[model samples]
Target: MGDPVTDPAPDGIDEGRRLIRLGGDKGLSLADRLAERFHRLTWRTPLHTLRLKGRYPLKLIAVPEDPILGDIARGTMLLEGVLSFRGEARDIETLDLSKPHPKPFAEYLQSFAWLRDLSTVATRARGAPIAEYLMGLWLTAHADTQGGIAWRPDMWGRRILAWTAHAPLILSSSDQIYRSKVLNALAKGALHLDRTADKAPAGAPRIAAWCGVVAAGLLIPGGEPRQAFGEAGLLRALGTGLFDDGGSVSRSPAMLLDSIQLLTLLQESYAARSAELPETVAVTLTRMVAALLGVAHADRGLSSWQGGGPASETQVAAVIEASGVRTRPLRQARDWGYQRLAAGTAVLIVDAAPPPIARL
Candidate 1:
């Protein structure tokens, strides 16, 4: 079989049309709008109050993973509750955990989601307890509110994955009470992901949300229903996010890498349960690997396309290695609209056609 027909029309046209129609008289009535407004107002008022007061969940669920690149473990040594990133340290308790954090620090905090890095260093012994402490701090300082960056769907998805992946490190404490709190919090996080995943913005964010839910479902006991829901959402996301040619809908090399990684995680999650890999997942993985190889340059790196930077050859090779799909690069990608030119050991890749109008 050949590649499926590429839709020349811009993406989201159908959705846009539906939204337009909904904006007409067929939309919600005035009373319904007023009720919605009232409900939103009530919801927001409390949330805003909570944000200002910084009231949060007192119980911690799982520890976030530390970044591979920061000196937080060393920095946290300086002050009892201080987390340092990029030469600046702030006491976790004093910072306004409810509002948006300042730049570099925010990025640092996000990286802190991968707390395993701290365990690899001299702070190995302190890693678990510190992780629990920081988590408790965040829970007490931020988790109760609903409108901050910490509560965003994507953030929640990330937190779930990070917590699940590093559960051992976070849950290592002898404190049974704290352990129970962490588990309960994880359950709540999974539930939140399930409820809010649909509202996550399209593409990678939605995929991440679904994948997190899938991971939670597979790892958490008695979670078959959540697992099924997650699998369904993930499959839907895969259908839209990937093209028949195995390329990403966004047509960006970077996104292709992300899709590959997402698939790998999903595959591993299923494998961990000794479950058969879903047929759709298996097939998609195969095609996506082929697509990645097809676009790869002779040097094993990708061409700069679709607002993506030139990827390092090492990075490309590593991604291929991680894919676990052994296949040669495709010589041509007609459906994806790319041409590969070769002369002896020299090679050049060119975009054969203009980007889809809709993407612009």
Candidate 2:
């Protein structure tokens, strides 16, 4: 067969081109590259080697290949550099062509080796379940500015739900091991805090709160309650953590957008299971939507102001719909996610109406 039909439709196509122009050419390319590069780097391993240096003249010793040992050595390096960017000056909004340093790009920088290896693994699997599983792992394991537990682990948790949520699309019989690893990592990250030492930021309680969102999903699938406590605790924090005016404690537009997304995801996940959200959480989410909507620009995206991270139209919509808030659009933040619709821009026209779709 020829190449798969991965191209997006007309509305999505225009939105993408518009995205490139608004976001920047370099960032878009980097996101695509980040996706491809990760799939490549993780497919294989080299023979194990042992180095010995002492007063005696000794050379390196060849040893039997051990996947587990190699994994530990490489994993430690991966975790360190990846984790370091957590407290750094990075955020997720600029992970594309616009900002000098996007969080996704940082993922590319910190774990290029792992990403490269992952890319290879994906190619070999080629349209297989392993590819999706690995891709989600690459995206989730990536360290955004939130550091150890935020986006990286958050993505891990989300992707697990995504897999479970859209099981047929991502998981199948051919990729059982891939599924196992993804699920296991998500479970471990959700339930086991001792696994990583990254702590919540001083300003935002949502970091810990978002962990609860992830833990909720992880607990559901694993049939365990250990993860649920943190999930509930995080929700409690998110309910109180979000400011009275619906803004993030950080007050960065980028963070505001991200927090909106985190809350929406949590709410939707619970809603999917017919769970009742705490009234405070619901109120906070609604307030946040109003606050973010107040600040959005004409283009339906944020103004890239105040050292904002990357905020896109899609993310904005997802949050808005998830928040169950009433909204109106401002032309300035057209690309801010939900603001486009709020502004009366027919997303189906811009996102769904396009033909002969574009591919990154």
Candidate 3:
């Protein structure tokens, strides 16, 4: 951990290259294939469909914190039938909702990440109907179980979180039939998450799917097994995707922020039940907070690294506050490959290794 300027030439270059080759050609393993077959068989059953159409969780374990100003502004625009997502916006009426959407936006729409913003509008009397109308349109267009972007694991994961956190907003409609439909859809989505959490591609998507599963388990009544499954999957994902030193496997700052938020939500969910937080969850959160603090610049913002965008100081601070952890910045990281140097009034930071292979 000496000064980076005087460090020896790094080792493991060839090992890295060899590892990359091994990873590049790797296909689904036998276990994965078997799991996929099980999923296909289980997901197609009429009993599963009937289960989805039944009663939903009567109460949510947690409601997401209130929307910020940005959410309100965007939500207002959405009420006007204008769709803005992934830095692109178009009139909802102008696009063909029946067919596939353009790149990024299609992914965005399918993910329903924008539902958070829409929930802000739904809090208002005038905006609630608009939110309901849009939800109805999307459901009619993309509720197919077999094939559709909406049914993708990652997309469904995000959608489940959105629908759960904003249940009050989505269920505000006067039409009891539509309310039933929304509840049924949410149940279906949760079931889908439970079935596919393990099959989800590694990293954030996998983590998200498990989180959704955990949320469903906690909120849905008579779902002890589902809740246990969700908790176990979430813990497993967290263990694998997060390093012992608290950095994410992907080495992305945005991912760190997202992880913090996810953990916060889970913590709140446990709190809602007056249950003890898992030791694994508590320990990982503490480590993640310290790692996040290590990467913060003097301006209190995270430096751009690992292809992550510049995160605002406010955003980072909010995440840390949400974690409820009090920790100091890491002065030296052995496994994480970062160094901090200070001399009188001057301070410097250095990246001590190549980007993660996944980033490459």
lDDT of 3 at 136: 83
Clash number for candidate 1: 8
Instruction: Judging by TM-score, tell me the better candidate of 1 and 3.
Output: 3
Top-down TM-score ranking:
3, 1, 2
Clashes of each: 8, 58, 0
lDDT value, residue 57 of candidate 2: 10
Error of 2 at 350 (Å): 30
Candidate 2 C-alpha lDDT tens digits along 1-360: 743322111121234443212222232356756864453332222210011111221111111110111123333333332211334432222223223455553543332223322222233234233335334544454411223323343344333333333333334446566565444443443443312112233223334335444434433443336344555556555544444445454445677766665555455455555564557666666656765765665445665644566566555665575556664322222233222334344332112111111221
Candidate 3 clash pair list: none
Candidate 3 deviant stretches above 4 angstroms = 1-73, 94-98, 119-122, 342-347, 358-360
The Cα error of candidate 1 at residue 9, in Å, is 23
lDDT for model 1, please.
Answer: 0.61
Top lDDT hit: 3
- In model 2, which range of ten residues has the least summed lDDT? 60-69
Pick the TM-score winner: 3
Between candidates 2 and 3, which one is better according to lDDT?
3
RMSD of each: 8.7, 18.4, 6.5
Q: How well does candidate 1 score on lDDT at residue 89?
A: 68
| Alpha-carbon shift of residue 128 in model 2 (angstroms) | 4.9
